[model samples]
Target: MIFSSLLFIFRFLPIALAIYYLAPAKLKNLALFLVSIFFYSWGEVRYFPIMLACIVGNYFIAIFLGKNQDKPTVRRWLLVLTLVFNLGMLFFFKYTDFFIININALFGTSIGLLRLTLPLGISFYTFQTMSYTLDVYRGEVEPERNIIDLGAYVVMFPQLIAGPIVLYKDVAAQLKVHKNRYTLSEIDAGIGLFVLGLAKKVLLANSIGALWDDIKVLGYANISTPLAWLGAIAFTLQIYFDFSGYSTMAIGLGKMLGFNFPLNFNLPYISRSITDFWRRWHMTLSGWFREYLYIPLGGNRRGMKRQVLNLFIVWCLTGFWHGANWNFLLWGFYYFVLLTVEKLWLHKPLAKGKIWPHIYALFFIVVGWAIFAVDTGMGDLAMFFSKLFIPQSGISAGYFVRNYGLSLLLGIVCSTPYPGRFYHKLCRQKKEVLRIAFLAVLLLVSIAYLVDSTYNPFIYFRF
Candidate 1:
């Protein structure tokens, strides 16, 4: 279930946390593992077996890799086999339909679409499991000998559905020592963070998302250039807060459970360059590609030409990884081009500027969101871009600005680091009571919104 839902907030989380706290230290992992399975299966009971198989399959594969460290041939084959299994499951579940459609289009064949409902969190947990296998083979981490510990890591509900994509090595110690590390301070911090993230999702992202949805419900032809731009900008805010808000909740949940997941977002909207944006946005994914895909392909250590090619490959895969849509590919390639230009020429001059660099960065970022919003064909994309640039269209800018102006303003302001800085400054003044009250108010308001509304949807669930 989504973190924002009343069912999750009122019932599931409370019950789960109660059980977890009541369990003895030695049984905590078992409690978490069982609850996590319940969490995953709550929405899709049929996929429980699939998720369990992944945990069991990868655990044994990692064990084999760890055991055969001295046997290069065996280790290599095992690694390849494990990777194939992980990636094979991912592709079959996530991309089989896309492949069928593409083949039908190109070969003039009428292949039926599989239309399989993708197993939730398959993309994220598959990556997690694969990383474990790779780390074991490389001697970066000892294989997790206990299947329950491994299963808990893979299926932990906090970051399971959408993630910062926790790596095995990063959390191996935490898992081993998790039972011994419960602290009141950590739980307090987690409560504050969880409330703050809840407010971001319920108060900010969901409210702003309506503006985009309203415009979208009005077809592309019904929006003027300014309106189109405003809608695109609204979506940009919606996605940032939605994904980042969920990440915040995940990290907070990790804290509550005495584990630490890495931070996923870093105020990416404040970035002044595409290169800077990648470093800040969905940072774990970028780091994943850099470590597993980019660096292995020789990174920038190869000459500029090979580096460029490597980037292109990574971006294409990155886009394809997001979905089966062509627009996602375009979105990926769009960044590739921007990043390539930045590397080749733009970085120096952009770094030299102050205000203009931010303007430049935001201009491309807004346009990029427009590309991301459209999921269909290039023709619709062309039409949307035409309306965005041409002034020949529908609604007046005044109406949109009048209606959504405050939300837009709040979105712009909150996208920066100032709000967080202000909060920390308040905390340093020995304002513990004030901080507690603020979080309490935020939690109450968020709960009210959750009870009243059904529009809550975490955007990253599709991935």
Candidate 2:
């Protein structure tokens, strides 16, 4: 049940929204919780118990932490226990096989892999629950006494699987509000944004992604340098549109439901530095690490050396958080190195430059995507890198250009801020009829594409 699917769009969403709107004000959260659990169970029913355990366990732990705030020693121990519970579940499901394979390679032990299925959104919900518990311990927010309201927050379907990673504090007030939580204007905006995102995912990302799929079928060793670069750029665009489009839809749906989810991507492709890019990309995740991990490790308060160490640890975990793959680790460290250099040296120079900074940032960003997308193992990654660097004349990119030129162009343009600016300008000019008409066309086109095409793939669902 991806959002792009006809079944979800026509069946589940319409029915769910109807049920939600018809519920009484005080029971809205209960309705939301029930519908959300059904949504999750529809996709991953086998892991329904695990999700329940997570919600129940974290709910009680947070309640306990809120109760024991006066005792520092007890609160600290409780926080530690909650961390172990959350992170332990994440590691056991996500990384157990990776550790086993590594140990087998090193010490010749044939430990059979458990190969447990990762519960969908465990990575995201774990962070959300942990943030709640941690904030309760810090006295930043009160513990949610009502388990149904807390469950509603944890399993909110829109951002549950692939998130902007909503925090508890961010929505605490909204969850408790009983009246006038939403407006007709907000619903109108949400519909427009959702249609825009649907167009982005169904039309642009899927079409551009086909070129990369073609290149993968041809194999890296057989591709020319031009085609390799094209494939990299295509993947870069595909991932951006896929994940950011999903995030946009999530945020839009949040608005429709009277919640304001935080922004995830902010024209990250336009960033001139790795540091700036992180600030824009998966922003909630970065903020999480910065607040919960980096600051606790002293951040920049202690000294340059300590700050560097803090960055290193955060990046390593950040990379691993994406997956159990070694390439992800390298991809993370790759940014760490770039960000370190930029922070210590290149920051001022990049700021001063105009065109070259964009070029440099995009060049490395594309290369980084190449690294991230090559998941077959180190051999394929090395061969792909060679194809990128060591030029070869084989299959030309001209054929792909002929096939995907318009989509590539649209993706490139949309990755910047021009389209967004145009939309805002329309709003500013009081062009309500024009805006609604345009969104209607986009929505119809996206629905047609969804009905006709079978290539819709969401990149972030695995995480």
Candidate 3:
């Protein structure tokens, strides 16, 4: 269920919050767990058991690792078993089709594709649970004895679907926490954040998505140069607002329940370079790969060649993790090539830490999305790029400019953090009155958008 949905906004959340805060301190975890289970199960009842299995299995694996700290071999074995178990599920559910298609293409034989139903949030929840055992194996954190706490950690509804990818160690303290009371201030802040996120999704992301989806729907054959460019730019905004808006809503909900979830996105489009952009975009995932993957792979400690190889590996995984498509792999490698080149050469030269670098990075990323969004060939992406600069024969170059005037304006505005920042500054300038006015208008407008939207799903929920 989307956070913006009428049922979620008006019914589920309000009832959950009331039950959550009203429960006795000892029962708070149970309340959160039940609500979270219900929240996820509301959409995918079949996946609830899958989620439960993950939670239970990972907890035991972590506990085993914790108990066998002295035996590196035992700990390593436990980690590997759990890793395989988790990744095996993810592979079967998410990547099985992609693998099947590739094998069939290569050998001209149908390997009998497993048309399995992918559980919702399998990508996200699996990663979160895996991190738990991984951290325990790494000696970064001790295991939690309370299964309820661990369950809450895994199923925390806010960031559960797409995440800031909170580490167990980071939130272990909070899960172990209990509060006698939740204050009005906390509720107000949570409500405010949730509403703001709803606005970001409904008003901005959804609006941009309509235009971007239209361009992609046109495919390569019919699109004009300017239209392709507009489509590419529109997609960039769509992803950022969609992902960041969800993160904001999650964070806001966490606040209302007095849980301090980590922040995810940070004005990523404003970043000056590919490296800077990675640091800003989907920060939790970046941090996760860096800490869990890069660091373990010896990071920069092994020097340049290994660093480059490591970068390639991380990007490939990042891409593949997003989807089971070849485009995702290519898109990831594209960034790897760009990032490596930037680190080795461009960091000191053209587009170095300047506005041009941001433009350059965004240029690469948007084109990457062109590759990502289209379920076609590289030639198709190439055609779109060709059209982007050299106009097609029939359609005028101004097709995008003419057709999506308002959406274009909204895309440009929502692309950066400036709107949120400017609003904050304005609020600080006038404090109460302006803040209330802003909130009221945004709340009503977001509600209107939600009411009208048939396209309301938190994009990351299927992650």
TM-scores for all candidates: the values are 0.98, 0.98, 0.95
What is model 3's C-alpha RMSD? 1.9
Off-target runs (Cα >4 Å) in candidate 2 are: none
As a whole number from 0 to 100, the lDDT of residue 184 in candidate 3 is 78
Model 3: per-residue Cα lDDT over 394-455, one tens digit each: 45437566666787687677676777787778656768677778889999988887787796
**Residue 276 displacement (Å), model 3:** 0.7
**Which digits, one per residue and each the tens of the lDDT, describe model 2 over residues 377-399?**
99999999999999888889999
Better of 2 and 3 by TM-score: 2
Model 1 lDDT, full chain set: 0.89
Instruction: State each model's CA lDDT, in order.
Output: 0.89, 0.91, 0.82
Model 3 alpha-carbon drift over 4 Å, by segment: 180-182, 350-353, 376-379, 397-399, 426-430
Range of the 10 consecutive residues with the lowest summed lDDT in candidate 2: 454-463
